[model samples]
Target: MSSFEIYGGKKLKGELTVQGAKNEALQVLCAPLLTAEKVTISNIPDIVDVNKLIDLLQTMGVKIEKVERGTYVFQAKEIDLSYLETEDFKKRAGSLRGSIMIVGPLLARFGKGFIPKPGGDKIGRRRLDTHFDGFALLGAKFNYDAGEHFYSIEAKKLKGTYIHLDEASVTGTANIIMAAVLAEGTTTFYNAACEPYIQQLCKMLNSMGAKISGISSNLLTIEGVKELGGCYHRILPDMIEIGSFIGLAAMTQSEITIKDVSWENLGVIPNTFKRLGIKLERRGDDIFVPAQDSYEIDTFIDGSILTIYDAPWPGFTPDLLSIILVVATQAKGSVLIHQKMFESRLFFTDKLIDMGAQIILCDPHRATVIGLGRQHKLRGIQMTSPDIRAGVSLLIAALSAEGKSVIHNIEQIDRGYQDIDIRLRNIGADIRRIN
Candidate 1:
């Protein structure tokens, strides 16, 4: 258990480059398991989740070697799907949400797969029901035992069929697509998740000889192929990290530039930021954030405050809402923050309140933030991080606060962002990581 001791209230001013997306890198790393040939990946972030995923892949007999700092050569030429039965695999499988991603590729290649209950943040009850439902519709029979939390899937010859997902679950859609890609017939996925991660997965699958159309749309049609081969693909830049940097610059009142931001891939992030009064300067492909004292929140004409809620793709991401909530404390007007995907995400607001943020916890899913609008300077205090996004939210709060603050459970923050303290420190952030 390491913690962060931050002496805040300093403007972090410097140019920082965003790393590769964690969400995209996680799935792409698993894509290598679909083929026996070597696959090269660049721009992979050096983070805890990525490390854990690499470890899991190694357990399944995939050979991974680092070519450079943020690049790697992965060859899944010798895969032992039976490694899923080991205690080490079971432990790692239960701790990472991305472990479930292996089920689809394994089932497609070996005609069977076994996985334990996957884990990540304790935000809410993210049911595997949709994942199982999608697999069932793809001609797989599943058995779940609660005491072991083990899931087993078996299919002799997968036949593609029309599947309308219960909801637009990202991982579920991906699992179904992976299984459907190797089936005998055509598979149509309606109301599928079209997030950048899913799109990247689709691109990787297509490169491997899987016939997939509608890369950016919700409806995906996959023509089953007999096999796939290794192909080179680069992971996308992290949009959540990009959004986090925007929140960081706004909170610190610092001028910063986000380099190499793929503006074309960012669907609704610009509009979402505009609603919170953050403007961007698009110079070619890069984004520049100018220094600002405060921003005004958008409100309705009826004189009632509106809430910014999270939804599926083409909507604001639920992951970045925590950062937005923390940034809103320094904005000009009040707004409601709604996290529809998770139940416990709003609980972290208690720490912000102790640091002098004016927030009303409406319920498990919503909170009303009446911004002091840069008029009140929050004083530093000791706190513990709860999850990944909330941990980053607390870090942002600490950076904006006055005096010194001690943040325990910094490992939570480290899980997603690599060398965050080191990176921020380069930009004049006074943060020290201590164990």
Candidate 2:
């Protein structure tokens, strides 16, 4: 097991570039299978999840070559169907949730796909109903094996139709879109997720000769094409990382600049930080956060305590709620954090409480953070990272604390954030990764 040993109470100052979007890379990496030509993708983060997916693809005989640091060329001219039934495939593909997305392209191109119950963070119940239902709507026969915790979807041919998602699920939207691009008829998806990742996926598909409209809106219409060709796509900046750095600067009283943060795509992330009274300046395509002595939380106009919650697109994402909740611990006013999407995401507040922060856990979904406003410094302690978002939040708290803090199971952090400790160290954070 690896751990991060962080020494706190020092202000950080420097500039750092945000890595490519991890979630988007997960979907885009699976996109090349729609065609027989080579697809080159740039700005892909070398994280555990991405690597796991690449390994799973390699096992299926999908020829992939890393052209450079963050660039890869994928050619799916031939895929080995026999790999799907192997014990190695079962062990490797089942380790990451993104592996499920492969089924969409596999079923689209080969008409047969099987996915084991994929796993990632144990945050909540992430159901695959939307994905399977969309495939069934496209004429795929779907079945589940309870004993093996597996799903089987097969179709001789796919015929697209109207699919209104019960919720705006990102992966589900990407999967269905991949499946429908090569189907027989036009597919109209209402209530689709319009996150930048989804938009990029649609745009990439369009570049590959697929017809898709309503790029930025929740309603998407895709015209089926005969085949998809090779395309080049560069993933966008990690907005979650940008938000994490914003919280890190504020909580550590650091003056940090985040480079090339595609402002057009970060709809509500910046303003959400502004609501917490954290000062940030937009520098061209970058974000400049100055060292803050203290910041005050903004309450509602009716004098209610400030509340931050997650919602669909153009809304505050649940991914950064843990960061915001941790930063709120040192702010001037109290705020309520409502994690509506995942029931167990807010449970990480208990770790912050152990670090001398004032937080009241209302329930599994809600937590009220009473800011200490740097009046009392947090004392460092040993902790384990529960999930990706919560792991970074704990790391930020450790940086703002008084002594040494040790965070174990940093693999969760590595799964999302690439080289987190190294990047933080370059920015003057006293952190080291122990193998």
Each candidate: RMSD: 1.1, 0.7
The residue ranges of model 2 lying beyond 4 angstroms of the native Cα positions read none
**Model 1 lDDT per residue over 1-435, tens place:** 899999999998888788999988878887787778888889999999888999889878999999999899999888886677888888998899878888888888888988899999988888998888888888899999899999999999889899998899988888888888999899999999999889999998999899999988999999999889888888888899888999999898888888888988887887777788987788888889998888888887897886899999988889999998998898888999999999999999999999999999999999999888888988899999999999998999999899999999988888899899998999999999988
Give all candidates' CA lDDT scores: 0.89, 0.93
Candidate 1: where is the Cα deviation over 4 Å? none
Best by TM-score: 2
Q: Could you tell me which residue pairs clash in candidate 2? A: none
Expressed as tens digits, the lDDT of each residue in 291-316 for candidate 2 is 98989999899999988999999898
- Estimated TM-score for each candidate: 0.98, 0.99
Query: Which residue pairs does candidate 1 place in steric collision?
Result: none
